[model samples]
Target: MTRPRLLPVPLAPLPNELIGSYLNRLADANRLPIRRIDALIATGRHHSRDKDDLTGWTLSSIERLAALTGRNSPALIHALPSLAALAQPNPLPTPPASLTPTAWKTKVCQLCAASRGVHGLAVQRTYPHQRICLQHQRWLGGRQLPISPRFHELIRANIRHRRLLRGHRDPLQPSALHDEARTMTSRWFSNNNGPLELQRTWDDRLQMLNPDTESDPHDDRNLIEMVTYPETVVLTTLLSKPHNPVHHDFLAEVIRSFGLDPRSLPALHRHTTLPSSMRNPDTPSHPSRHRPGSKSTA
Candidate 1:
């Protein structure tokens, strides 16, 4: 039996030592263990050392990585053809050296809205619901060969309610068959900038939007579950507060949970009463009205 010939990992062959050196420096500065270093190296290698693969990072991430590597990612990206040549079966083609990283990401056929999965043989989604990626999605998406149940569900969700999934609402038309209350509900959706999510389609229309024709309005309850907030923002709103007091305790809990300083919060002063609008037309009398006889000697 013949022993298999093993290929040695090629470290020294990388065109520019700059990124490699900085990665090494990071390993040293962070006191990164050998395992961590190997993982990092493997990660870079897994991409087949393609420069465009490197550019897939958000520009901000690239900037941060540059700060880490002590080399400008933009410059590194500019030198990509030379760099990517080191990788076999280079995924990107050699074009004019003038292309920039952001330009490259923007140019990649994958990002083009027109080329998405439903649009492709892959049957994978072009637009992800804030999670999942195109490749595995394609492999699993049976349309490629074996169809994906998840892809079907996702497509059904998107097609069944395209506008709603995108957080848009349906247009309500006037109909006398519906009562004034129902009319108000439909128009409310128009006013609130909705085709709310499937669940929210039944939420109270009195606040911001109108009820939908999609489901029974009478059954509406607890429609806030679908809400997903941005990572940086934390909403700590009050709930189940007293009608009269407006419940200060719940408000405090919200503030505490939000981790927002009251000082930074907008000033809110409570008024014991509404505006009286009383007009006092009194002019202070000079010395004449001031107890004329009391200080008259002055």
Candidate 2:
């Protein structure tokens, strides 16, 4: 029986690393063809991800590679971000069978791909709901790509958005708030008198924020920019809160800021109550006249 050769570098896998990336790195560092590395761990000649044998890897192959790399199987597997979800009690749903790897690039975080020591693109950090890279405080718009000119305003709001996720432990809030933010911005831009000029101004400002987008003016304006805006997120957060006597006027005030009459928003009235209905001895001068949590008339 032939003894398996040990890796020259014996690099330990990083957290959230992809199995494919690890194999590629091992092959690159050892000056070996990637296909040879693939053959060493492959259970058969089956190719996944279209002729990428690494994608069709099996557990026995992982164990074999772990030994070759001088790392434990469990540790190696734990470091695989793509497989991490499978370990959960409720694993993520499998992707559609017809979808190809090329169709899935936008799902991953761009900044993580640009990280040092990464061999190539890693698929482990792909969470489509995640529009912001909290680690880099940048936007992840494309495959392993980060948008430029990181907007301090949007970054600050994204921190609060993450806070809401952590503070409440609600997985749904991020997407819900994100959706509402886009809706608010779309509504604002939809019925405006100077839509073209306003859109041009917004596009120009957005270009300043992400200079790469300026090179391609024909590209559709990224909605994530609107969704991550501080004002948009602030309103979305406030709207997500439970309706109370304290919030009715506050919500109405925010609605009015978009140049629309508060009275036109019946849904807002339904979700919030008038302050007058629950006013105490410490109540302010008027119900619809003050912002929430404030002790003054509007």
Candidate 3:
């Protein structure tokens, strides 16, 4: 049997009129975490500067909420602001406590229909303010999608058409974060380089082949890539083998980048003419050698 059709619940930033119309909805399906909702308002104020819609919404929602509760929503919200309201201590609370980075990510993804993706989840510094995820960053049509493009655009455009045009003019609020991320994405950054790390994997394979002394690091990488090497062809063959189940997708790319066969890692692991203490640490160290900046061999 087919599964029952689930109705799509409309996301919020719902207007005042619709909110009143859906007042019973909030009362019945009070799935809204009041603390979280309040925290969201506080976050808006912190990030949006003078342009805070949620605070206005909160002021109104609280008023209406309080009238329903036979108390005051504004007073209650003010008297006991959510953790997001407390600006100094913690940037943002993680799962169960407030909002998990994952939950925030999933929430943004859902809101945007995941056109790109929700970034900023990985950016630890700006807990509340971070880039869109790799998924949401819109590179194609040439628009840096803002956090609340749909939500804020409607408001900003209505408020000032000259300022907020649709994906037309300048970036909504220019941010320097991506510049920093791009500048940082080079060489042996743990996240960037896979082959450099293959030092261990290559060593393991060579050890299994001969079970001999630790192969020179340079020699090892070289052997792995060497045209003269049989093992060099082995992994490549695994990908092309008709009988093999998995494709060597990455291996193909590696071969192309490193060439059909490359230098042996033996030279890589070889010690320099000068002692370790004198070497420039910024330079990549060979196996059994320390990078220069570290506690020198002195």
Best TM-score among the predictions, by candidate number: 2
Global CA lDDT computed for model 1: 0.28
lDDT of each: 0.28, 0.53, 0.29
TM for every model, in the order presented, reads: 0.17, 0.56, 0.20
How do the residues 186-286 of candidate 2 rate in per-residue lDDT, one tens digit apiece?
54444332224334555665566546743653243454344336655666566556555454555555565545554555544333333222344554434
The predicted structure with the larger lDDT, 1 or 2, is 2
Sort by TM-score, best first: what order?
2, 3, 1
Worst lDDT run of 10 residues, candidate 1, spans 271-280
The clash count of every prediction, one per candidate, is: 11, 2, 24
Model 3 worst lDDT run, 10 consecutive residues: 97-106
lDDT of the structure predicted as candidate 3: 0.29
Top lDDT prediction, candidate number: 2
True-vs-predicted CA distance for residue 248, candidate 1, Å: 38
Query: Between 1 and 3, whose lDDT is larger?
Result: 3
Candidate with more favorable, higher TM-score: 1 or 2: 2
